[model samples]
Target: MQYLHALETAIIYIEAHLDEDIGLEDVARETGYSYYHMTRLFKSAVGETVGSYINKRRLSNAAKELLYTENRIIDIAIYNGYESSEAFSRAFKDIYRISPLEYRKNKHDFFIGSKKGLNIDMLKHITNSITLEPTIANFKETKIVGIRGEVALKGNGLSCLWEQFHRIYAAIPHTVPNRRDFCVCETNQTTYKKNGDAIYSEMIGTEVDSFEEMPDFVVNKTVKPGKYAVFTHMGSLANLEKTYDYIWGTWSLSTKEELDNREDFELYTEQFYSMDNPDNRIKIYIPVC
Candidate 1:
């Protein structure tokens, strides 16, 4: 979540300058991370780089405005910071899979979705080379008590959700260590909004010993055990997403194993605590064949 904070900060900045000519270097400097680092972090965490995400979002907004408002197509394009309607239309078509003129004539009848955009829950499997190091192992399902929040794939929204969780969990005395804390993210991309954000659950077990006090937490899920491709995230929250891209986009493509459709999760390598340096460490456990 801490690495997410830095990204959230960057997104907020991008939104403010949607109409201006913004550069990656400028944004990276503002966020105190290098361009390469920021790009990798964005890819790993959100599955899209900052520039691509912004372009798609801007074009989406422009398209919406074009249909809803009577503004000239060129005006709408320029307003959203595109230099030429031609340029805007090309980009818009690439994302929406339709031209702007057709879209406008339909009068907001349809919406454009991003092609380069990614699903937030899909785990990326990265390794130095294509090696099946016998990392697969069995895991029993876990039942945890925790609070939940809805989040977008990209936005300042998730950061706020974490803050809210901190507030709610702080009031509950049951969140202390030895009880163990669990953050569960429920993924349903069908309902995932334009922002690519979805609902996530933050849980602190009230009944670590048993399910006597299920409390307000949902007890409906039984996480299945299977072989998993594991990757270690070393140091700092910012680079986590890059690691994901390496695994999912690169390593998975090269390896013989195919990803198994199951709930992926972060395995706390050490005593994982957000209170500790968020960038410190964690393991992404992706179910695979």
Candidate 2:
């Protein structure tokens, strides 16, 4: 899709100019999109606004520099787009729950225990098994009725949310065909924690034609229409993290496409036999520009 291709171009442009002063107009111009159109398309596809993504990426890169280099805090801050050490410290503390100096001092211990340091052999094995290529798909606007919650990206928050949703899914009326279930991940504000955990709104639901006359207890959400990069995840649910690690850590970084700031979801189709079955398969749809 042209939109997806353009988005990828914008991401590449942003990444290359992270140390420079870049803005929406610059990115939109590079991708041949109007600022308004690009903003809408980007927010609908990537889940974070363009400005947010840039800021986060800059801060993330700054954090890495703090850990890996001997540069002073002010220099690191200025280099990453901040004008002053105090301003950078505030932003850094917001996401990482630590000042830049504190982060640098404890970086090794914190990162070593997190998902960022996945075992090389395990990552290779997971990447080897899954096809990293994604199919472009267009979806119409969809209305889903189900349970929603603020979930932590790490630990059992997602699993617990699904378990809760399953307990009441049967009572929700008027589900769509093929028993398709969706696990939509979205962001309300800040994306991640200092420890590398992200907080997002997770909705577990089935597609519905409309939201009218829904029960008071049911939460209704609309999935905006757009082009998506749909990748299939294979193997049991227990090992699903490995698949995601490869997608975000490996494939996304290598591809020309940039992740859209829209809702990314997991679609459970008929092929998803059971959580324990090694043959279980599910489709993961990521909005891309």
Candidate 3:
């Protein structure tokens, strides 16, 4: 709780001075954590660098100003700690997919990329139960057969998918002795964009020795053999996305390893306790070249 309290302090400090020129160094100093410790802990727990969280908060605040006030865009930019309007526009367009003028002009279909500030409750849920660091593994090719469906980017879409899979689980034929299950994220890359703006396809399946006599509704997927960075998540399944945010947001970008672009999956073994149990263990495998 010592470090988590420090993280909470950092978030409060950032929120208190979103309009000020708050640097990572300043936040780290305020938290009384060393610069290295601050960055690493922030990355693991918040799923982003301190710099990133600050900028997003600034932009999120600036967005509200644009909508609610008649302030000049450049003035709003400076108020948000951006040096110039051009730099702010570039940063804003990267996440919101449009210029400030476009965002302000259209009252429809715009979004704030990072809306909420970090809180201690969220940090504890993300950090206390999981080993955020990952181990690299050379995984073997495997096959699975299960139900697949379109799931929304938010909410309990996954629970419904898993329910359908479990109902048909006993009917599957030629299963391997390993009872481990795979919750594979089969995102359709063509329509996919960052920040939950595309159709999400997911599959829940178990390893199978053969695909013979499989039900027509169920399709088979092949997980190609390759190197992967395996991360272990423990605790309630509700906190699972926090772990993914850390992987995709901070770790994947900061690591020296190259992403292999293969299908990544959640591996559920016998060690998995009930979904609500804090002892639940689920392994996440991300392909790396």
Most accurate candidate by TM-score: 3
Q: Give each prediction's root-mean-square deviation over alpha carbons.
A: 10.6, 12.4, 4.9
Q: lDDT per residue, candidate 1, 130-179, as tens digits?
A: 22233666666665444555544444454465556555554343333555
By TM-score rank, best first, the candidates go 3, 2, 1
Model 1: CA > 4 A from native: 1-134, 167-180, 189-207, 217-221, 273-279
Q: What's the CA error at residue 144 for candidate 3, in Å?
A: 0.1
What is candidate 2's local distance difference test score? Answer: 0.74
The models' CA-based lDDT, in order, is 0.57, 0.74, 0.79
Residue 253 Cα positional deviation in candidate 1, in Å, after optimal superposition: 2.2
Sum up the clashes in candidate 2. Answer: 14
In candidate 3, list every pair of residues with a backbone clash: none
Distance from true position, residue 61, model 3, in Å?
Answer: 8.4
Model 2 stretches astray by more than 4 angstroms: 1-115, 118-121, 189-191
Provide the lDDT at 88 for model 2. 94
Question: Over the stretch 1-289, how does candidate 2's per-residue lDDT look in tens digits?
Answer: 4666777788788888988899999999999999999999876555446776677678767877786679999999999999999999998776666788898887532321122323433434354446567888987788888998887656767778878888888888878877888888765443556555667678888888767778887798888788888888887766767667656644564456766778788888889887777787889888887
By lDDT, the better pick of 1 and 2 is 2
Model 1, total clashes: 16
Better of 2 and 3 by TM-score: 3
Q: Higher lDDT: candidate 2 or 3?
A: 3
